[model samples]
Target chain A: MSIRYAILGFLSANPLSGYDLKKLFEESSVFHWSGNNNQVYRTLVELHNEGLVTQEVQQQADYPARKIYTITEKGLAELRQWVLSEPELPQIKSSFLVQLAWADQLEADALDDLLRKYDAEIHDQLIVVQEHKRRSKTSPQRTPREAYLWEAIMDNKILYYETELNWVRTVRETLNEMGKDK
Target chain B: MSIRYAILGFLSANPLSGYDLKKLFEESSVFHWSGNNNQVYRTLVELHNEGLVTQEVQQQADYPARKIYTITEKGLAELRQWVLSEPELPQIKSSFLVQLAWADQLEADALDDLLRKYDAEIHDQLIVVQEHKRRSKTSPQRTPREAYLWEAIMDNKILYYETELNWVRTVRETLNEMGKDK
Candidate 1:
């Protein structure tokens, strides 16, 4: 449902082909909010079926024709309604945390190894988020208000990763201290 | 898959009826990693069918017969294997964040309203997490190591909510300032 609205929200901005939507999602750092290619295409079809969105096929010279999607007025209204509605609590499902929950059964070395591996993964994610932030800032053509909102979203993403990295470090340090006592 | 391992981990500790598992999930702060009653029962059946767990029917005098689920040796092995495996990146899906991403389309007051509503939601979640932490600490019978791991998990959850609440406040403040400027 959120994915449906996310697509509608993007289409409300401009008509876009599936490829264009995917590119926009990646470029705008909305990929996290989007489904994979198949899911996106399927949702577009569903939206068209529901009259929430309309599609037009564009002829190409040599390449295959592209089906462009445009959000209908109903879709725009639904997106706005969703945006104003009570926010659903995001389902938390951290597999890393799940491992940590049961880590007491693991040996200290193994646990330390797990933490370090997770730390590295988070570090990489932090880098990706940083890059996204940079791209968001340098991208031109947005209204000041739009840029402000985009920055706020990017800032939130950046801080989320930074917080995770810090937590990982704290846990690692604790594990190290525990290792010394054993 | 994470839910399966979480259930297996709990069952490895002790046999539990679906009701017991659901209660423990809420009490132990593993609810985020678990599903609802239907999912729990269905997964238990799946596990039983897969020979990873076995169910024993206990006839109750006043209530319906309870099916107590016990993890098989295979289940324990699988749980351990999963815990030791590389952790998958948790997918991020915050409807609040999604709304914020497109919030430039909304009026200042509407955006402010949205942020305030989200803030209240996070506040409620923070209270739930804190209560879960207190219960985790007060509950007895865990070994020192088990307690340590539990504390770490609780700490992660607490910090996550705290960070989110702080971020929400920051966003609201910025929104207010934007409103003032406008």
Candidate 2:
């Protein structure tokens, strides 16, 4: 699915400006997605032309007038149709796999540094997931199901990061034995 | 990193034909990577032209004589430099997440099925992790550090999958209350 669909889906729930959609995406599902700001604005224009969403211009004194988009009935129908359809398998292109693939040709020290950096990244993400979980526990708007689902997703993320950190430590230890520090 | 490096890295280990390289990738660290035959063959030709790899035609009885490639010293140096360099952050673009981001648009039943499928996939992966852990226990060629690292990776996979499965179940239960069935 394209980011266009995501924008439309968000608008389906309530009217939102392009800026609002961007903010919602980052706050709600930042871990699973990333989008170029240009791409989001571009998709919004295309979605408007396609008649899936309509824009209302609101005047503001302190800022520029904003275009707020709401999903049309046709758009809601399309979203439902898209959901019933089977999704294509996502392409997995991971840099970690590439680095490891060529590890045999790499210097011992280089491999150690890569592992160390990777370890740090996982640790940082673990912290983010933990903080997200703690915050969700107190949010009043969250239904019981949404609360539980959010916690499960964050917990899974924490466990995954912890696993990566543990794995990197082991890789670093192996590099030390091979004389990486030297 | 590009698939070009992955192919070159494998040749740096030992001279191997396209078929052999494919098999090695499947069994090696590159197993986590997905490379089609066209990409592998194209990368091999590019490497040969760039003088990063040397190819030789070898005669075989049952199959056609294949061109095997071995990495040149220059290729090894390049791979080494890459390993020492900072790794790019891992970026993912998942259609599954895109679908979930617009989940409000889905029919309750459709959304329920999606959750169920995701849950099943995570469960299946957890089984694979457990099997890997079991195999690592019996392998003697594996160093102590290697065993620990591999196990840590496996444990993380298990945990992540379980966490995802739990999220799916919670989503499904919520959808069920909305009259969605799996």
Fill in the DockQ of model 2. 0.30
If scored against the real structure, what TM-score would every candidate get?
A: 0.92, 0.73
**What TM-score would you give candidate 1 relative to the actual structure?**
0.92
Q: What would the DockQ be for model 1? A: 0.64
CAPRI verdict (incorrect, acceptable, medium, high) for model 1:
medium
Interface RMSD, per-candidate values to 1 decimal: 1.6, 4.1
**Candidate 1 lDDT, tens digit per residue, A1-182?**
44787788778777888887676666654446443688788889999999999999999999999999989989888888888888766666687887777777788889889988988988898898788787664233257777777777778778877888898889889778877887
lDDT of 2 by residue, B1-182 (tens): 67676666556656888887666555432245444677778888888888888989999999899998888998887777775666654554456655654554455566678777777766776676577666653222234444444454445445555655665676677668646323
**Model 1 chain B lDDT-worst window of ten:** B136-145
Best by TM-score: 1
lDDT of 2 by residue, A34-131 (tens): 54578778888888899998989999999999999889988887876776666444333557645654554445566677777877876777787678
The candidate maximizing DockQ is 1
TM-score of chain A of each: 0.89, 0.78
lDDT for each candidate structure: 0.78, 0.64
